[model samples]
Each structure stands twice: as structure tokens, then as C-alpha cells.
Target chain A: MESTADSRVPVLNGRRARNKHDKHQRIFEAASALFTGQGYSSVTTQMVAERADVGTGTLFRYASSKAELLLMVMNEQMRLTTRLGVAESTDAASPNDAIMALLQPQIHLSLAFPENTAVYQREILFGTEQGRYRTEALARISELEDAVGNILARFAQTHRIRKDIDLNGAARTVFSTLHMELIRVSLGRQDPQTLTATLASHIDVLLLGILDPE
Target chain B: MESTADSRVPVLNGRRARNKHDKHQRIFEAASALFTGQGYSSVTTQMVAERADVGTGTLFRYASSKAELLLMVMNEQMRLTTRLGVAESTDAASPNDAIMALLQPQIHLSLAFPENTAVYQREILFGTEQGRYRTEALARISELEDAVGNILARFAQTHRIRKDIDLNGAARTVFSTLHMELIRVSLGRQDPQTLTATLASHIDVLLLGILDPE
Candidate 1:
């Protein structure tokens, strides 16, 4: 009887673990779809629980409130984005190429998941909760800026960029250009192909002006 | 007695006119403050009227609803912007110079009225009734794009820009870069002088890459 009971305990534990994982994922997907499709302000926890087909109490087990759910969704998004971004850097030789590679996946993702992008963009601009989340969002933007700056700095040493130029500012400019283009595309103002081509052309312009003196 | 009646009529009419004008100005100022300091949805017409020390009926006379108030504010802003923008082109020599001149004043105004810029940015991004204002907003952006295109076309003909490059795409890129930079500055992310200098430097870079072989 003891041996049988011990064997059942492992089975029960495995089932509980799987159930917990499934519940968390259901809550996340429910929150993401609702928050992205409608404005975040309009979404509620009860609605999320109903959509996820989970009890309201079960929903609370995963996320304390709507804001916490949003944070969790964003956290999952960041993890995926970070992983994809790092993967893009693996084979890149120069910092410029690496940064371009990093941005390409993001651009594709932004296009593919425009609703998600919209939600996050608004969150970055208007959401008031400070501390860790704000820091994370700022860090992502800064990392991209630094990636561009690193390339420009190295290029400048060889006289590729203007010697007196502020590398950080230039990097920020590059990032800002890309960010705006993505927004414009999402807003239906510009075509995706044109946005991509313009981005490439602009980068070339920057490179030509910054390249080593002949 | 007839002369006394005539004098009274003019005095009453003058007072009524002054009261109406005062009410309108009060509503406008109150709405601007609330919209800037708080997100749009959070601000109520009652709050605005109270803040302005006016009756709710008085607020309705100036703006039918909060949405209308936003439209009115934006219209006034764009009118002022257009005046400043148009003035800059009058003394400019070339189309390129004209565009650069035109954008400068608008950029300066954005820096001065950061809150105004923020309100417009949010409205453009998420307002549901945006259809009512889309035409005018897009017309302004298109006008800027056209101005830039004309300059690039002329410059290309003179071998000032790359003869083979797509003028349309290049024009769009230029406008996008400038617009994004202005927003960044208004959001307090970039300093005015740095933005101004960076724009000039980037424009030079762009011209070099596109200009015909000299």
C-alpha cells in the first residue's frame, strides 16, 4: 500500500504542474489578445478570465490584477524579443551589420504583431508605473542605441564617421528613425517595402558620410 | 430719451460680446491644461468647466463635447503652425532651403509647447474619432513631403542629389526623420541644439550620398 501511494504522489504532482503551466499560459494569451485588440484601459480581469475559460479565482492565482497581467504579457514578449535579438547577433561581423540583423527580426515581428506593438508602444509612452518595468523598457531602447553607437565609435576611430560627432546622439537618431518608420507603417501611412527600402537607403547615406576619408 | 436708449444698446451689446469672448478663451485654456496634464480619457468636461470657473452650459457653447474640443485645439494649433511654416519659405532661395526653413519654426514651436505636442501625439495614435481629423492632419504631412520632394527633384536635376535614387522614397525618409526627431525633442529626450545640429549634419550626409557625381 505504501509503494502504491508513493507512486500516485508523483503522478498527482506531475498533473498539478502541468495544470499550473496551462492555466498561466491561458491567462497570458487571453490578456494579450484583449489588451492588444482593445485599448488596455478597457480590459478587465473578469473579462480575461471569462475569455480564458478559467474561473475568476483561478485567474487571480496567476495575475493579481489587470496591470499585473499586462506586465506578465510584456515580460513574455521581452523574453522572446531578447532571445531573437541575441540570435541575430551571433553571425554578424561588424557592429553595423549586427545591429541591422538585430533590427531585422524586430521589424518583422513588429509587422507580424502590430497589435502587440501598438500596445507596447502606448505602454512605453503613457504607462505610469515606474521602477523595474520602466527600466526594462528603457534598457531595450538603450541597448539598440548602444549597438549603433559601438559601430559608429569604432568607425570614427578610423575616420569613418565625423570626428566631432556625438556617437550616442547619432545612434539615438538611427533608432528613432526606425521606430517612427515602424509606427508609420503600422498606421497604414506607408507601405512595408517602401519603409524597408528607405531605411536601407538612409543607412547608406549615414555610412557614406561617416566612412573613412579617401 | 432716444439717445439714452441708443447708448444703452451699444453698452449692452459690447458687454455681451466681451462675455462671450471671455468664455471661449476660458474654455480653451482650461481644456488645454487638462488634456496636457492628464490623459484625454481621464479629463471630463465638467472638470474643465469647473476649473475655468464657467457654467457647464457655457462650456457647451464653445465646444459641443470633449472630442470637439480636441479638434478645435488641434485646428488652432495647425493654423498657427501653418502660419509660422509658410513664413519661413518666403525668404528661402531653393526648395531644400525652404523645407529646412519651414521645419525649423515648427520644431521650435514644438519645443516651446511640449504639452501641446504630447496631447496631439496621443490623440493621433489612439483617438477613435480620428477619422474626422485625419484628412487635415495628413494634408499637412503630405504638404511637407511634397515640399521636400520638389527640392530633391530639383537637386537631382542639378546633380545635387543622386540622379538614380528614388526621390519619393528619399523625401519620405527625410520627412519621417525630421518628424520623429521633433517628437523626441518635445518628449524631453533630446536637447534642442543637439537636434538642430544633428539634423543639419544628417541632411549633409543624405545630400552627399544622393547628389550626382560632382
Candidate 2:
């Protein structure tokens, strides 16, 4: 009886964990589709729940609000993107280039769904959403920041970057450019090339001073 | 009879313009008070109109929406602040210092009314208000950018800055730092001292580069 009960408990726990993860994945897909296709505001939680084949109660249990729902979807993509960023930048020829490569995926993410991304950016930056998803997303963003800092630290080890410069602050500067360019691009008033050029130049300024070459 | 009609035309025209200007000032004060005291979302156009003692129709005539009302208040302050930026930055010794001085008042403005400023910034940067006030605000922002550009150009004249550098782009980089810091400050999650330190370092990176100064 003890052996049978122990075996059942492990199997039940594994199955339950898998079930929850699968449902979360469906919710992510459903939310992404609705938000990308119909935009963030027009889509309702009820719609996402139905599309995900989950009850509204189930959806709320996962994400307390639509903002949380949005964060959940973006946060998952960001995990993949952060990994992709590290891979892409690991072999960059210079610190500046490495940082650029690290951020290329993110800049494209903004360009891909500029509208929804703008709302996500707003919430993450200034929206008062207090959901755990936001907390996870914040942690995910910090992971990306750490990834950039890691690249910089690697360069500093090679004496390419200043050892004393705040790697974390510098990482923020890189993403600050990304955020500004992302917001500007979302206006649909500026070309996306401007985003790359401006970011490149900002990175250039950060690494190589604008002071006249003595 | 001709003389009487001509004299009355100047007096009557002067009185009408004065009345319109007076009402517009009243509207500005009323909107600023409501937006500041009660916050942007809580206050309605009707409340502003009533406070200003103007008809709601008249308020609508001046500002089509609440966003426009917010923009109107900010734009007026920005006009005065631009002049202050110039005066404050004119005598700075370095391009970076000059740039920082130019942006100080603007930063204070952001800090003082961060919540309203955050909304105003989100709208200006990404919101699709498309009102004349937004247009004016964009123009005003451009003027500030131009002011920063002009400061960089002034420094370049003495060969302190690289003449080859795009002053406009550099000005943009400066403001990009400001925008990011302002948003961070608005989150009220970071120390304001951190804002100055980050911006100063960003300016240092821009002016002095981050490579080991070998």
C-alpha cells in the first residue's frame, strides 16, 4: 500500500505539472494570436480563455488581468530571445558590436508587433500592473540586462572596455536607446533603419568619445 | 461716420482678442489645477470647463480632448523652460555640461509632476493624439533638440567637439538619455540621485568615450 501510494503521488504530481504548463502554453498562444491579430485593447479575457480552451476562472488563476496576460506572453518570448541574444553576441568582434547583436532580436520584436509591443513597453516601464507576470517579466528583462553586462565584462577582461565603467548602467544605456528607438518606430512616423543607425551611433558614442581626436 | 466706425474697429477688435486670450489663460490655469490636484484621468473636461467658468463647448473649442488639455498645459511650461534651458546652458565649459544644464529644468519638470509627465510623455512619444497641441509639442521638442544641437555646434566651433559628428544625432542621444531617466524616475522605483549619476555617466561616455584612456 505504501509503495502504491508513493508511485501514484509522483505520477499525479508530474501529470499535474505538465497539465499546468500545457495550459499556460495554450494561453500564451491564444493571447499572442488575439493581441497580434485584433490588438491588445479589443481582445477580452473571455475571448482568450475560450480560445485557449480554458475556463475564465482558470485564466484568472494564471493571469489576474489582461496586462498580466500580455506580460505572460511577452515574458515567454523574451526568455527565448534572451538566449538567442546571448548566442548571437557571444562571438561579436567588439563590445559595441556584441551589445548590438545582443539587442538585434529585441529591436526586431518591437518592429514585428510595434503596436502591441508599445503597450507592453508602456506597462513594463510605467504601467502600474502588479501581477506576478510583471514580476517575472521584470526578472526576464534583468536577465537580458545581465546578458549584456556579461558581454561587456568579457570585453573588459580583454582590456577593450573600461574596467571602471558601470557595466550595469552601460547596459541600461544600450537598452535606453533600444526603448527610445522602439517608441519612436511605433509612431510609424520614422523608418526602422533610423532605429539601427541611431542605436549604432549611440553605441559608438558610448564606446568612442565624440571629442576631437587629439 | 467713417472715422467713428474705424475707431470702433480697433477698440472692438482689441477687446475681442483680449477676451479670447483671457479665457484661454483661464482654461490653462483650470486644466493645470485639475490635472495636478486630482490627476489626469480623474478630472473631466466638464470639470475643467466649470472651473474655468467657460462653457464646455468653449473648452472643447480650445482643446478637443483631455490629452490635448494636458498637452496644452505642458506646452506652455515647456515654452518657458526652453528659454531657461538656453540661459542655463549658455556658459557651460564642456559640450556635455552645456547639454546637462540645458536639460536640468526639463528634468525637474519631469520629477515635479512625474505622473502627469509620464502620461504626457507616453502620449507624445507613442500616443496617437494627433491634435494641434501634440503637433505644437513636437515642434517644441524639436526646438529643444535644436537648442541642444546649437550648443554642440557652439562647442564644435572651438574644436572641443568633433566637427564631423552629427550634432543633431548627438542632441538626440542626449535627450534619449533624458527620456529614459525620466521614465525610470516616474516608476518611483529608483533613486533620483541615480538619475543624475546615470545621465552624467552617459554624458561622460558620449563626450569622453568608455575605452581605457590609454
The fnat score for candidate 2 comes to: 0.81
lDDT agreement with native, every candidate: 0.69, 0.80
How would you encode candidate 1's per-residue C-alpha lDDT over B117-169 as one tens digit per residue? 75566565545454444446656767767777776677777665554578776
lDDT of 1 at A168: 75
Checking candidate 2 for backbone clashes, the offending pairs are none
lDDT of 2 by residue, B112-193 (tens): 8878888788777876767989999999889888987787667567655543467688778777777878887876877887
> Considering every candidate listed, which one attains the maximal TM-score?
2
Across A98-117, the per-residue lDDT of candidate 2 in tens digits comes to 88888888887778887878
Model 1's alpha-carbon lDDT is 0.69
Worst 10 residues of 2 chain A by lDDT: A205-214
- The digit string of per-residue lDDT tens for model 1 on A1-214 reads 8777866645535888899888878888999899878857678788999999999998877765555677667666666776687687657876557667767867876787665565566556645456455557667767766767777677677655556556675676577568767776766666888766667666666666555344
TM-score, candidate 1, is 0.72
